[model samples]
Every structure is written in C-alpha cells, then in structure tokens.
Target: MSRPNCEDFRHLFVNDTPLMDMRAPVEFTQGAFPTSHSRPLMTDDERAAVGTCYKNKGQDAAIDLGHKLVNGDVKAERVAQWKAFCEANPDGYLYCFRGGLRSQITQQWLKEAGIDYPFITGGYKALRRYLVDTIDEVAAKPMSIVAGNTGSGKTIMVNVLANGLDLEGAAHHRGSSFGRYVTPQRTQIAFESDLAVQMVKKLDRGIEHFVFEDEGKNIGCVTVPLSINRAMQEADIAVIDDPVDVRLARLLDDYVVKMQRDYVAHYGEEQGWILFAEYLEKGMFNIRKRLGLERYEVMLKSQQHAVKMMQSNGSLTEHDAWLAPLLEQYYDPMYTYQLSKKADRIVFRGDYHQVQDWLAAR
Candidate 1:
C-alpha cells in the first residue's frame, strides 16, 4: 500500500481531525495545533544526544546512535502506542518538526508492524506557516466590531453569531483584569494558532466577513495579531446597549456565580471560596489607579462588604452596590469615552436581541 504523505491544511483544521505530533514533549508544550496531541518519537534527552552526535560524527553516525538508543522495548513501546492511536483514529495524521527523519522513521516502523498512516508533508512548521498566512489573507476581508460597555454581554453577542471570532475566548480571557478564567491561558504562539484556525474555519464556510468584540491590542498576556487587530479597528461597529441593571446582572452571573462555580470545580469548596474572594478583591484593586484614591477606597469598602454579604446572606445583590458605582463611575464613563473616539465606525446601536437579529440577518 502506498503511504499518504502531507495533509490538506484546510481539511485538517476545519474538520478538527486528530494529529499525532511526533516532536519531543518540550517542543510540543510550547505550541501545537488545536486538536493535535503529543506522541513524541524520542525523549528530549535522547533527541538532544542524537543532535550532538550528528554535529560531531555526521548523519549516518547520528542515525545509528538514534537507533541504538531507542531499540528493543523502547522502540516496540513507541510503535505500539502509535499503532493503538492509529487504530482508534484511523484518519489521524502524524507529524514531526520538519516531517523528515523522525516522522519517516515512525511511518516505516508502523508500516513494518502492519499499520500505515499519513504524515503532514511539511510537518508542524509548514502547517503553522499556512495558518499564519491564512490569517493575513482572511483578515484582509471586511469585518465588524461588536462594541459595548463593560458587562454589556458583548462577548455573548459576538459568540452567538456564527461568523464571529471570539478573541477573548481564544485568549482564555475576558479582556479585562477581572476576566481570568479557571483554565490556564494559552501560550502566545498557541493563541495565535488558535485565532488563525478560527479564521480559517470561517473562510472554509465561505464567510467573507466576520465579527469581533472590540478589544485592545492585548488580551491578557496574548496580543491580537497586528493585521487582525487593524481590521477590527477599522471594521463597522455594532454597539450593545443593555440597561445598567441588566448588564450588572449579566456581569454578576459571569464574574461571580459562574466564576465561583468554575473555581469550585477546579479547586475544592473551601479553597475555591478563598480564591474567589481573593480574585474578586484583586480585580477591584487592580483598577485603583484609574478609579482614583477616594473612589477606589469607596469601591473597596463596598466590595469588602459585598463579600461579607455573600458569605452571610448567600445573595448576589450586595455586589450590585459596588458594581453599579463601578460601572457608573469607572467602566461606563471609560467605555463611553472610548466609544466616542470610534463614532464614525458605528453602524448599528441597539440592545442585545436587536444586535443578534441584525447579525443573523447579515
């Protein structure tokens, strides 16, 4: 049977197929495709040793040493793992850094052992370059920006649209100091890869235009790619204008109730509550400079009282005390000022359902 080499980039990512990454774990941890899993051909130290041998004694000597280092049970075990994965995910592809020596060895061994699987032609590097280039191409198309005040459910609006790129979701952040999620953030490279994947998927669907929430250059530690960020800045804008009460309720549901539950799910109850309280207070404290000394003190006092109320009353209403002022005194004015600068970009301004309907019809 002829071995299949290389994979169609769009199909691999759009379908969310399995990928067996044959690079060392150290390399895989830094970044990888979304659905890919690490199944390294050699241990990091082994790869290192082989590299040293290649530099010292050349390719043939390095190959012999690599074989020697991974022979017998080690080789058998690695092949067995690949075989099992192939059996379970028959369409899955294997890849190495350059799709050269390591992946060739893996395919040959798997073939000898009565298993045959394809590897991406240019491997991880090629696929990554394809994705990077794809993003630049896709970002050149027209797009829209979903602009809203804090707690205005702008994320929900953008996410509900089939064609929207949820930048905050891609970055695993809500795009605010208080927006940390229970999950660890993606590495910067991983973030860019994921964002590109999202754009490519949209492109595959024949989507020429996409929507994104208005975001700064950075989302948490990960920055939006320059081309895409420029597109977002220049895109037509839709504003979500939910009432303060509604926005506050949404914010509490997202930041407090949901966040607390996520914390509890990840940590135990006691520890989760402690962390929840800590994060809540820290989020408020983080904006101290912007909030000013007197306003910050008031907000802090209100926040401390709200925490006490949560512990004693098990009610979220106390949070509204601080949240309302925080929005009015801080977030509302701040967002309004920012929105003013982009007034010419505004295409539609309405409540949540209205924005959703407009996007759906588009």
Candidate 2:
C-alpha cells in the first residue's frame, strides 16, 4: 500500500491526521507530538516488564511472553478502541517507541481487524530524529534579533511573531534575578530536547521572520544551545522602551523582594535583608552570591513585601513610586549606557505605549 510522504505525514499526522501516540502515559507526559492524543497501549510498568523480558529472555521467548502477558480481553479492549478511533478518522496515524515492536504489533492487529490505519515511519523515534536533525538546519539560517533592557517584553514579542523559540517562556520563568520562578525547571537534556523541537517546528513552518529575546547564553541556570546562540547573532535587534515609572511598576509586579513573609514581618532583621540591601544597591548578581536555601526564605519575604506594596498600590504608579526615584537616578542611567552601545537602531520607541504598540506588531 502507498504511504504518506514526509510532508504529507507531517501535515496529516500533526495538523491533519488524528494522531495516536501509543507510548505509555508516563512517556507521553514527558513529551509527545504536539498534536498527539495518547492512548497508552501499555502502562509504563507493563512496558518495563516487557522490556525486561526482551532483555533477559531473548526475542522469541520475550515475544511469546509479551503475547501471553497481554491477556486476550485487555488486548481486545485496546485494539477495539484503537480500531474505532482509526475508523472514525480516515486519515489517522498511530505511533510507538521505535516502530520496532510496539508499532509493528499494533499495525498487525489493525490489519487483522481489516482497519487501514498507518503508523509513523519508524515510529515516534524517527519523527523525533527528523526534528533533531532539522534543528541544525534552523541554526544555520539567519535569525532576526530582539534586544532591549531587562523587562523589555522581548520574549513576549518573540511569541507574538511566533518565530524563534521562547526558551524563557517555555521554561515558564523569566530570564533574570526576578526571573527565579515558583515552577519546577527542566533537566538539561529535557530543556535541550524541547528547545530543539521548538526550533525545528519554526523552520518547518518556513518562517523567514525569526524573532528572539536578547539573552546571554544562559537563562537563569538553563543554558541555551550553542547552535541557537550562534543563530541569534544574525538577527537585528529591536529595542523596547517603557517609562521609568511604568518600568518600575512592572518590575515590582513581576518581581517580589520578599519571596518570604519574613522579608516584611521580620523586616530588615533577616538574611534576605542583606539581599534586599544588596538589591537596593547592586541588583541581581549580589543576591545570587549570597543565595542559599535559608536565604531563599528571606527572599520569599522580599516577594511578600513587593506583592503587598504592589496590591495596595497600582502597578506602575502608586506601588512603584518608591522605586521610581532609584530606577531613574540609578538603573535608568545604567540601562541607557548599555543600550547606547547595543550596535542596533532604536528602530522604535520614545514612550512605553509606543514601544508596547510597536512590540505588539512584532
């Protein structure tokens, strides 16, 4: 039977085909095709058991055990559901680990049931490999750059243009001292894999307009791929500007000084007081230097303080007034000095609204 071409499979299996990833739920949770609807044919535990069998029992014996272990009633139930889904969607595709054992077995059952479902070529493994290899292709191409001072909303614009990968957003944390987030971060391998996947997806879309947030090689503790880092250099920078008060308000809302309640309740007495003092003076680097688990407790206090002030006061106005003077006299000058040397045009901006509107267009 004729099979779908690569582009067709991509279109159908991803955008068009009803996608079924047969990996266990645990594997699916780790990652799956963007469009895949997981109906784990086997649980993770079951898959592990089967894998152990294959490892120790050899092929024939393992295959025999696998068949036996998949009790007839359970197999029938899974196959029936799969058959129904495929029959319901004429252009459906199913995939499994390496397209070796699980996918082949599923395909055989589909055929035996007189269903015309297709499997991914080489299964999810091949599809992932295709994405992995294409990452180099994307990295080699030129990308447009977005550069600005911190809180420039460059990453937000990156998503608006939907071009370059939003590693910062994907990680669900900002890329700064204030960026320390409440969420659990990814493992290095997982982050890299996810980053590559996003890059490949953008390339596949044939997007010429590559937009990326200006960032150092590392965002917090996560390092961007070297390939992506090099790719960023080719892009032009778009500087975003916001009013001092507006920026301060944003800073306060987004970043809390009192990450802990003690930051205020204990006020100036806690270790975070030193961090707060350093923040009022130096900024992020100093806080990082003194950071430890206990310090984080005090940091929480800072967040609490920032939050209290923010809620009681408006985001950019009343709440940020206290910081406004410091920002204008200190941070603004430092930012201006850095921006002047960016080697890129202002391209757009005199005010916060203007910058916001322009960045919105990006």
Candidate 3:
C-alpha cells in the first residue's frame, strides 16, 4: 500500500502524491517531479552546511552536526507537516538527495510516530537513473509522433494528452529563445532528467503515441534524447496547420509585449527599449521578413511608440539584421521543408479537442 518503487511512481502520480522533496529548497526551485508539490525537509542553507561539513569535517562530524541541527522538536515539526500532507494524500512519497540519510531520518521519524510508509528506495538519484534508463528503453520500442511548423500548438497538445511527453514543458523551458516564461532555462543535466521522467510516464501508460514539437537536436540549450528524436523522425506526422495570420498572431502574442506593454518589456524596459529604437526602422523590416509582412507590420505599428521613445533616447543594435533575414526567408523555410521530407506525412489534422479525441479514442 506504500508508494515507494519506480514501478509504482505512476500510481503515486495518478493518486497525486505531495512529492515531498527532502533535497533542499534550491534544487526544488530548479526542477523536480513535475506533479509533486514540494516541501523541502532541509532548507537550502542547512543542506549546504551539512554538505560542507561532510566534505570538510568527514562523515561522522557531518552526521553529528546534522543530528544537532535536526533536533527532536524540529523533527516533530517536519513530521507534523508531512503527517498532515500524508493524511490528505495517503500515497505521498518522500525523497532526499540520492535517497539517503536525509530521507532515512525523516522516514524513521514517521515510523517512530507509527506511520508505516515506504520511502522511495535509493531516492532522487534512483529516480534520475530510472528516468535515463527508461527513456532509452522506451526509445527502442516504437512511438508515434505529431510534427508541425512553429506555432503549430504541437507542444501544447502534448501536455493535454491523458498521457505523453511534453518535452518543452518537461524542461520547464520551451524550445525557443523567446519561450522561457514558466521557468528559466534548466541546467543541461536537469533538463535531461526531467525529460526522461516524462518518457517513462508515456511508455508506462502502454502508450506508443508520441506528440513532439518538431525540434532540432537542441531546443535553446537542452538536447532531447536521440532515441526519441529517431522515433520522431520515423513516426507518422500531421501538420497542425493554422492560418498564417492566426499562427502569426499566436507567435507575437506568445512572445511580444501584452496589453500594449512596451515591446522593451519583452526583454527589459530600459535596455531592451534602447535596442528597439536604434534597430527597429531597419530591423523592423527584417523581422517583417520572417514574421511575414502583414503580421510584422502589425507588431511594428504596435511597438512604434516604444520604438520612437527609445530612438529619442538612443538606438538598438542592427547587427542581427543580415542573419535575421536569412533565418526568416531561407533557413527557417528550409528547415520546415526538411521536416516535411523526413516525416511519414500527415496522419491526422484537427484542432486540439479534435486531436485529443482522436488520441483518447485510440
């Protein structure tokens, strides 16, 4: 009845375990289990102190100091909070760095209180290992993919599925420079760990259907697994076509300023504003080249006042002008063409509800 093993992680996930992370506040903030609401047993400073103690003073001293820090009253407080959480989620699980002493201490406290729960064996390290191993295993098996051009909502649909990998979301980062809204770009290892977690979930659901945003080897900084990429290349694809205007609107709305906010806020008001002014007249045309004339014109008009304000103060760099057009007119289009050439071609095409139903029925 206890949620402990990797084989049961999906059950814990479905049951909505609190995912009590005992690692430390900092790591939790970076990235951890996607569905888990984390409550760190050790504060950032406390964990760091123990780590320093372990390295400098040796294991015995570290344990003594850790004991000194984690006194009975404080321990009781942790048990109380976790007890309350577990009361609500009887299936909740706890993990510490490497699933070691910290988690052991916490679990012992639970047992002393007569709470018989099994903690994740081997901790986050094991979970991380499971993620890597499982992703590789799943990749060797077949998977179906949904591929499309930029703004195809392919990434969005992946998350909506009853089960699947949301690579862009998994990374807590999107695949584009402009797509780092929900969380800052993750460390390379962290991104991969997160992705592997999703892969395991998808494969375990008895699901071979994979929906991937047609990404290059690198999405900003994170590199997706080659196996998953290979599967994507081989799977049947369907272009999630939206009108150029509609796609264009989504592109700007997702990236550019909102509520007519100064375009500079997209970067930063002061510095980004200055850049917009200095480069926009010349640069604006270049952007138009990629975003397309109509959409580009719309954003330019919207950003015009901000452009003027900055120009009155200073100038934006125009250095990217030459390459921007190349990326816009030639490279981007070519990339799409290659994706079309590579994929098995459209298998299904509809809006998400339609597509979701298609996936649901299957």
Candidate 4:
C-alpha cells in the first residue's frame, strides 16, 4: 500500500499537528515550527560529507555516501526512533528540508519496518512559506492599536480582547528595557513562525479585525513582520488613559514584584534574588546614557536601595522610589512624544475598562 502525502498546511498548523523534522540539527536549530521535533536523518557532519559528494560527484554518488554513512546499526537506530515517534504521535507527519530524497528514504524505511507513514508534500520550506503568507493575509485586515504610556496595562487590555494579537507575548519579551523575562526570548526565525501561526489560528476562528499593542518595529530581540508593522502604523489607536498612580502600581507589579517571583521560581530563593537584582541593575545600566548621567546615578542609587530593602524585609513598595521617577522622568515623556506623532490616529481614549469595552465592541 502506498502512503499518502500531507499537503494541507493550514490544517496541520491549525490543529497543532505533531511534525517530525528530518533536517540536520543545525537546520532545526536555526528555525522550526512550534510542534516540530528534530529527529534528523543525518548528523551535521554526515550531511556535510554527503553535500560535498553531491557537489563534487553527483546526486547518485551523494546517495551512495548517505547510505554508507547511515547504514547497519545506525540505520536501524534511526528507524526505531522514527517508529517510536510515529507510534507516539499517530497523527504526525515527517518531512525534511524539501519533500525530496531524505523524506522519501525515511518513509520507505518506515514502510519496510512494517509501519507506513506520510511525509509533508512540500516539507519545511513550504510550511514556512505558508506561515509567511498567513501573516501577510491577516495583516491586510482591519486592525486597532492599543497605545498608552509604559505600564498603562496595554498588554493586559490586549489579552482581554478577542481579536487582540499580543506581539510581545509571541516574542516572549514585554517590549521595554525592563521587559526581558527570566527565560530567554525565542530566536528571530522561531518568533516569526510563532507570530505567523498565531495569525493563522486566530483567523481560523473568523476574527477579521485584529487588535495589536502599539509597538515599534523591534520587540526586544525579535521584529514584528514588516506587513504587520505597516498595518499597525495605519491602524486606529485606542489609548489606555489610566492615572499615574495606577500605571505606577501596575509597573511595580510587573517589573519588580512578578519579575522577582519569576526569578525565584526558576533559580531558588538565594540565587534568584541575586539574579533579580542584577537583571534590574542591567536594565538601568542599559539606559544610563538616555537617562542622563546625573539622573541615572540618582535613580540607580534608589534602585539599589530598593533591592536591598526588598531582600531584607520582602517589601516591594520601596521599588516605587526608582520606578516612579523612571516612569515620570523617562518613560512618560518619551511615550507622550511618541503618542503625539500618532495623535491623528487616536480613535478612543479612556481608562482600561472603557478601552477594553471599545475594543470588544469593535
């Protein structure tokens, strides 16, 4: 019996289908789908050898080298791994860089092992193209920008909306100097793949109008796709106009309280506290030039005192000393200037609930 080739890329992504990536480890590390697991047919060295043979001799010679390299116990071991993955993810499909020789050989081996499995028709390249197209297609729809000063709960508001696209969430950074999480952000390729998959899933649910947080091109290390960024620039803006105290409290919770808790959770109490302090200090140091030498010095001193106080008494309130000034002196003015440039695009300006309601109604 002949095994079928899976070509419904949207179905695979929408359902979060398990994918067995047969590319070399180096290729998988560069980029892969969220559901993809790297189970390469050739090691990087083996692939390099075969590639050289293909260039110097030809495809037939390359094939001979690949067989010789991955034969005997090696071949049986790989087949066993594939069989286990197939049994575990009965609905999963396998693919290589292209729907070419590597995947075909794997499928044939699986068949010989008495387990027939399908491969993606166009493989990794095609799947990536599908996701890219999804982003462009969804970005063409109507969109709304959630714009506000730092810590105005814009991200929170975005999460509350049905049509909202949390770009920062996809990028895994909070979109600020203090936004780096305890965990590292995704690779640029992975970030784009994630964002594109999100668009696909959201659009599948019939969400035509997308709500996105106001952001520049870069969100920490990852970039918003140019198509989506352009749409955001042209989209209507909904400003979350919370009081200064409210914004400050929100920021304190997010940056200091929760961030500390995250570090502690990840690294245990002692080391977590040290790393937490270093994280904040590094954030401050990163913006020293922009904050001005004198002001930065003052703020850094306050921040250091706040960290010590928190370490001693578990008092998070002391963070407000530097955080308040950071917002008032640095973030507020900068955001206010940025907002002014997009003033013409402002469609609704209200506190969190009102903005939430406005976005929901849209």
Candidate 5:
C-alpha cells in the first residue's frame, strides 16, 4: 500500500492507464484527463466547508474538519468505490488538484483497506500543465494542412491520413456556424488536452509529420493552440478538387442526413427535427453579415422551403436549390480568397481519390 509501486506520471499520457480524479465533480467538469473517472474524496459541500476552514482557521482546522466530514459510513462508501475502480483497473492511479492532501488521504485510506494503488505525483493541475506544454512543443514540428472548398470531404481525407489529426473532431465541431453537433463541444482546456494527446500519440509512434484540416483560429469556442496555429499557417496545403456536384452531395449527407440522425439520437425524432430546423435557422442568421440582408432573406426562404419539403416526405435534392447558391455566393468566394492568399502553400491539388492516393503513398 506504500507509494513505492506507484505508476509513472508520464505513463498516464503515453499509455492507457486509467486515472481516478479525486477532485470534486465541479472541478472535474471544468477540466480533467480524458482517461479520468470522477471519484471525489469529498462532496462539493464538504470541500467548500473544508475550504472555508482553511481560509478562516488554517490548514490544521481544515484537515480536521475534512476528516470529521468524511468519517464513518461516508468514508467507507467512498473507499468502496475507489476499491472497485482499483480492482477493475489494476493500473489505475488517483489524482487531486495538487496531488497533495486529498489524493494522499484517498491513497492512505485505500491502503488501509488493503487496496494498494498509487496516485499521480503532481495531481490534476500538474498533469494539465504538462499536457499544455506538450502541445506547444509538438506544434514545433511540420504540419500539412488539408484545404478545399466547403464540402469537398477534406475532413474525410484528413481522417484517412496515416498521420492525420482531426482538429474539428477534437473540438466536437465542423468549424462553422452550422457545424454544431448534438454533443456539446469540449471545454477549452479539454480541447487542448485532446489536441495534445493526439500529437503525443503520433510522436510516440515515431511520426514527425502531422496532417490536419486547415482551420481558423477558433473551432467553435475552442481556440487552436497558438503555436500549432502558427505552424498551420506555414504548413503545406493539400487541396481537394472534387466537382461541385460531388461536394454538394457530401454537404447534404453531412449537414442534413447525418446531422438529423445525431439530433434524433440525442433527442427523440419529433423534437430532433424541430431542433434541427432551429439549428439551420440559427446558422443562417449567424452568417447574415456576410450574406447581406437581402441575400440572407433569400437563403432563409429557400432553407425554410427545403425544411417544409422534407417534412412533407420530399427528396433531399430539394435542398440543392439553396445549398448550391449559398456555396456559390458565400462559401466559395471566401475560401477562394483565403486560398489565393496562400497560393504558394498548395502542395497537392486533385480530386478526393487522387488526394487519398497521394497522401497514402507519402
């Protein structure tokens, strides 16, 4: 039960060792490791009480109150939960805000219960710092940015790469107003943690070249790490040259069919459609500045018509009328202007399959 058999702290990042976050639910929700499960050493109320004691009386008083609060059946139940987690994941480690009192106490209690488990050396804050530092360090390496018109299946191509990192996937967004997913986006810290984890895994595998979709500074609410964004700005661009029709079909599949499916899966069918329609409306409204009031109204009307047609058991093709014009008038010009500014960065330009082959061969 001693700390001699403790797992190495870096192993938590590089390997699949599970982590039991002993921070309260509120703290854990704010941020924690991906592999972590919330198993608090104290309830939120108990933690607040202990914190107040620390502030008012001192550390000794807080410790006394903490022990007093978690004693008897409450302590026993928590120990049981920790024991179960340890038993299930023999390599599991525990952590607190600073790898200090709380985790030490948890480890000590578990030790007394005959469950010999080690905790993270520096705790949640330390591990988070390490992960954040790793992101900038890894961002120094060369990156290849996948670029194409909207709906060119650039995300799919990035995903198919051997060394591809899905920035949008990490953000739980498609990187646009309409790109909201049924699931919530990660907190900023969580998004950075995820991005760092991907890079760490790739680097650990001896891969130096990282590939990902070209993205703006923000993917939804999460900003790309500054260093990574800088590298992306300097990275070579791989463009997808699929025809308009091909790209349009992909947009429909992703935006309409897959989006509706996700919404229904999260919220039942009846409510899902309603939410989906709202999402579309919001997405359109969000782009009103770029679309101009008149053009926005036109697009909105077409979108509403498409929604009604779908509701009436009409074909998805009905969406093409608005989508095509939206792309032609809005998305294409923006993307083209952006790409033109970086014309020197374009490394490979081809159709989807051609790009796939080009990446695979590399």
Candidate 6:
C-alpha cells in the first residue's frame, strides 16, 4: 500500500494530533510544535556531517553518507523508537524539517519494519507557517482587553470567559516579578505555537470576538506576536476596578498562599520552603532599583521577617506587611500610569462581577 502525506495542518492542531518530528535534535531544540515529539532520524553530529557533505559534495553523496551513518544497530534503534511511537500513537503522523529526504527515508524504513505510517507534507515548516498565519488572521478579529490593577484577578476573568485568550498561561509566567512558577517558562517558539493553537481551537468553536488580559508585548521571555499585540492596544478595554482591600486579599491568595502551596507540591516541604523564600526575595530584589535603596531595604526586611514568621509559626498574616505596601506604592501607581495611557480605549470600569457581566454581554 502506498503511504499518503498528511496536509490538513489545521485539523491536526485543532484535534491535538500527535506528530513525530524527524528533524535533528539541534533543529528540534530551537523550535517545534507542541504536539510534535522529537524522534530524530539523525543525531546532531551525524546531521552536521551529512550537511557538510551536502555542501561540499551533492545531494546523492549526502544521502549516501546519511544512510551509512545511521545504518545497522544505530538504524535499528531509531527504527525501533519510531515503531514504538507509532504503536503508542497510531493516529499520529511523522515529518522532517521540510518533509524532504529525512522524513521520506524514515517513512520507507518504517515500511520495511512492517508498519506503514503517513508523514506530514511540508512538515514542520508548513505546520509552523500555518500557525504563524493563524496568529495574523485571528489578530484581525474583534478583541477586548481586560485591564486592571495588579492582583485584580484579570487572569481569573480571562480564564472564565468563553472567548478569552490566556497569553500569560501560554508563556507559563504570570506577567509579574512574582509570577514565576516552579516550572520553567516555555521557549519563545513554543509560546507562540501554544498561543496560535489556542486561537485556532477557540475560533473553531465559533468565537467571533476574543477577550484578552491587557499586557505589554513581552510576557516573561516570550513576546506576543506583533499583530496580536497591536490589536490588543487598540481593542476596547474593560477595567476591573476592585478596591485595594479586595486586590490585597486576592494577591495574598495568589502570590503567597497558592504560590507557596505550588512550590511545596512540586519540591516537597523543606526544599520547597527554601525555594519559595528565594522566589519571593529574588522577585523583590529584581525591582530593587525601581523600589529605591531605602524602600527596597525596608521591604526586604519586611519580606524576610514575614518569611521567618511563616516558617516559625505557620502564620501567613505577616506577609501583608510587605504585600500591602508593595501594592499601594509599586504596582498600583504603575498600573495607574499604564491605564492612563489607555484611558481613551476604556469602555467599562467596574468591580469583578460587573466587568464579567459586561464582557459576557459583549
């Protein structure tokens, strides 16, 4: 039976289709789709050698060299891995960087191994291009920015909305100094891929207008695609006008209680506490210059004292000593200035429920 090439990239992404990436490890590391599992046809060193041969010699010579390099037990081992992945993900398709020689060779080898599998036409490049285009396409759709002061539960609101896009969640960072999770942030390419997939999935559900949290271009290390960011800047804004007391309680739950619980769950009690303390201290120290020397020192002392109190007595109340001021002095003023710039775009300003209802009605 002849093997067919898969070309429905949208279908693949929307359904979370499994993909077998047959690119070299180095290429895979730089960027790849979220559903793509790396099962390289050649090792980095082998690919490098083959590439050098192709540059100096020709395509035929390069192909011969690749075969020689990946032959025998080496070839058998790779084929075994591919076979196992196919067995595990029977519906999955495989692909190389360009859906060229590497993927074809892998597909042929799989045939010889008694398993016939399809490969993605145009491969990783085509899939990536499709996603990139998706971002640009969706950017043209109507969108609203959910803007608010820090700790106003903007993320919570975004998550609750039917058409909302969680950009920070895609970046795996919370869009603040204190936003780092125990897990590392996604690579820039991975972040974009995730965001594009999200937009695609939402669009498929017939969402006409998207709702997004107001954010600067960069979230952690990942930058939002320029088109989307530009659209967000011009989009109508719904501000969450929760008072300081409300925001403070929310911040404590998020930055302190829930964050500490997350660390503890990931690393266990002793090590988790050490890292959690470091996370908070480092977050504060990251903005020391802006906080000014005296103010930074004061907050640092309060934060340290708060950490010790929690460590000693298991009490969380002391955190408000620094957190309250951190909000009033740092985040709130910064938010006020930022919101002022976008003042003309603000369409509605209200507490959480009001904003929620406004967005829902839209």
Score every model by TM-score: 0.93, 0.68, 0.67, 0.95, 0.93, 0.95
lDDT of 6: 0.92
What is candidate 6's CA lDDT for residue 17? Answer: 84
| Candidate 5 residue lDDT tens string, 1-362 | 42333434455667756889999888988877678899999888899999999999999999999989999999999999999999999867889998899988999999999987888777888878888887887788777888899999988887778798888887889998788888888988888877777777777788887788889999999899898898899988889988889889988988888887888888998999899889889999999999999999988999988988987795687899878987888999999999999999898999889887887676
lDDT of 2 by residue, 1-362 (tens): 46466335345533545678889888877766555688767878787887898899888877787788776998999888888888777777888877677888888888988986777777777777665665567777756566655555566567766565687865555766556543456645456555665665665677655566777688767787787787775456666666454566566655543333334454444554454444433343344344544644444455446545544552323334334443554456666786677666446554534544555465
TM-score of 2: 0.68
How many clashes does each candidate structure show, in the order listed? 1, 19, 4, 0, 0, 0
Better-scoring candidate (TM-score), 2 or 4: 4
* Candidate 1: tens digits of C-alpha lDDT, residues 76-188: 99999999999989978999998899999999999999987888888999999999898899789878888889988888877788898888888888988788888889888
Flag the better candidate by lDDT, 3 or 4.
4
Where model 3 places Cα greater than 4 Å from the true spot, the runs are 1-7, 52-58, 72-80, 112-116, 157-164, 186-201, 234-236, 240-242, 256-334, 337-362
lDDT of 4 by residue, 43-147 (tens): 999999999999999999999999999999999999999999999998899999888999999999999999878999888999999999998998899999999
Q: Where does candidate 6 stray beyond 4 Å?
A: 1-5
As a whole number from 0 to 100, the lDDT of residue 59 in candidate 3 is: 93
- Model 2 stretches with alpha carbons more than 4 Å out: 1-3, 6-18, 80-90, 112-114, 162-165, 177-205, 220-222, 233-236, 249-362
For candidate 5, the TM-score is 0.93
Can you write out model 6's per-residue Cα lDDT over 88-174, one digit (the tens) per residue?
999899999888898899999999999989988888898899999999988999999999999899999989999999999889999
Model 4 residue 233 distance off true place after TM-score fit, in angstroms: 1.5
* lDDT head-to-head 1 vs 6, winner: 6
Q: What is the lDDT of residue 26 in candidate 5?
A: 87
Candidate with the larger TM-score of 3 and 4: 4
The models' CA-based lDDT, in order, is 0.88, 0.63, 0.63, 0.91, 0.86, 0.92
